[model samples]
Target: MSETESKKPGYAEIASHFRKLIADGTLAPGDEMPSMRDVCEEFNVAITTANRAFRTLKEEGLTVVRPGRKTLVADQPRVAATASARLKRIARTGKPYAPNERSVDHTAQLRSMADPMLAQLLNVELHDEIVLRTRTFVRDGKRTVFAVSCIHMRAIIDVPELLSPEPFGQFWQEVYTARTGKVVTKSPERRGARLALDHELEALGVDVPAGTPVPVLVLVNTFSDEDGPIEVWEDVYAPGLWQVDTE
Candidate 1:
């Protein structure tokens, strides 16, 4: 099977499909929503299954209840994010990651940890200092991405502010390159979506749309050279914020 055709689909994925259509203006305000049967047939799912998807849209206030008619798209819309756009928002640029708001970007801290696996994977000793640098991005009170990066602490002990959020990815790359003569060639990444846990929803200060799958974007990145892995990045994004096409 082609890469795209093999993905697993759940109720949340179904909800997100329609959510993107609505957010992207495919389904505009006052446009009649497709009948539940239409959703059922299109997705090849049962009625109860279809309802779960629709219920999410309703709870998120993305859809409106007409007095006696089918639900319509909400007058106020939330923008849908593309996959590539989502990953690079912080990595590429600084301002206005989300619509109508500039994200609150800040470096939280540099945490120290010791691990045998990370040492083995990165080819270091067990006592090697592995530092975890975390940065947060928030848009209009909602946490968009929690960026956690792992690298050997000695690589950055001299440049402490490398932990800060503002000029993270690029600045760190430059420093590491100059120091080691290992210019980063590529950052390979893998991504997928899944339902958010209750605590996750609570932490984001947003509740899951009822019966609707609350989708969260998971990204794993490994920055590498001709050698193996040098630096790694793990990032999470709120669902429906990422663009579908990411290369």
Candidate 2:
């Protein structure tokens, strides 16, 4: 029997099919997959069964669920594949390597603003002005290297106490639950490139020699609530220090 013929039809089977689509570029990154109803009809399964298949894809880092919208494939499949190739190459060499470990320290704060768009996203009552909570994360005493996050004030109204202190008073997971009563799933979009902003050089503590390029990795994350998207955040990293791997 053919290998394809031997496989059973179910969530695992569906996930594998989609995985191949992603790897072979049949479905490019940011490409939306067929709807749940469509997949169900095509596979001759119930809606619930199709949903489980999509959930499997999500857990595998292959897809993202937009509340009230279609599921879209993630673009980092290439990054994951590249990391795997590097690991295999290293294994073949049998070279000894030391492990480096670092601790990450995070902090958050609140900011007041008058931007109408920002206010609307936060679901805050606009008074011609609004307040936003900014979360800043600093690693290893480096002031320039940090994550500056802006969150809408309306979302955290019930938990005004979160605005206090360094750790931002609460973790994003907890905040997500408290505000929207839903779990926040993280799907990272990665891009390998060079730094563009002058401030980034200072923050990353890198001295760029003339014409030499520094590796920069950017992660854009969309935080979704039970109903849909609540917030989107961008994280920039120095490749020399931070590395991402997927199995």
Candidate 3:
């Protein structure tokens, strides 16, 4: 049998399929999800595998399970949409943000890689030429995250828009795909915490207590296709603006 034919759908793959459906609005709020038996038959998976997929959705706050009622899509998703999910929304709609959400483009320019951590993450030499795109994300008129996107110089050559100071108003990966035909298939992410640097505090407009070190949540995502890395995005979330959604 071929490799593709030998593979079976796992819980993560099942959950991702449903996530895309919800992200694109195919599964609207209050829509009843298929029963576990239905899922099992559809994917030809065992009951345990199907149940695990549903459990993953529930843990992500994308679905609600009542005591005596069927599982339904949550009216308001507690967890933020994944990057790929947001891209799906942007593809359908013109913008990604909700009515009360917006982003301010701070700067986009070609610069030398200064941070050793970023260089290592991007798999580039120190002081290598890279494109820097910075933005501030706001929700309900409050600054929530300061974001920085580091792109290899190749992207700017392939898709010149990466050097534009003005926002593309869409994910650049889509633009890159359009220009170079290299589709992003995977995006690995990492999370950590660190004390806010002086520039980061200024950019986020955060004030730290005198003589006290203020910590910020850091989320880094690396976008890549089959070939390799496309871009690295680092988001510094303001304190009190980050929350874990367990519901």
Best by lDDT: 3
State each model's CA lDDT, in order.
Answer: 0.60, 0.51, 0.76
Model 3 TM-score, all chains together: 0.64
Better of 2 and 3 by lDDT: 3
TM-score of each: 0.47, 0.40, 0.64
Q: Which stretches of candidate 3 lie over 4 Å from their true place?
A: 1-85, 88-94, 209-211, 243-247
How do the candidates rank by TM-score, highest first? 3, 1, 2
Q: State the lDDT of candidate 2 residue by residue for 25-143, as single tens digits.
A: 56777889998888877876677778888897787676887788788986542123232322333343332111111124444455554435434544444453332333222322432
lDDT for model 3: 0.76
Q: lDDT value for candidate 2? A: 0.51
For model 1, give the RMSD to the true fold. Answer: 9.8
lDDT score at residue 245, model 1, on the 0-100 scale: 29
Per-residue lDDT tens digits of candidate 3, residues 1-247? Answer: 7775468799988988887677556788889999999998888888999999999898877799988999998776544443444555666665676434678857998889998988887878889989999988776567777889998877777788778778886677788888788888556567799988877787877877655688888887887766677688888877755433211
Indicate whether candidate 1 or candidate 2 has the larger TM-score.
1
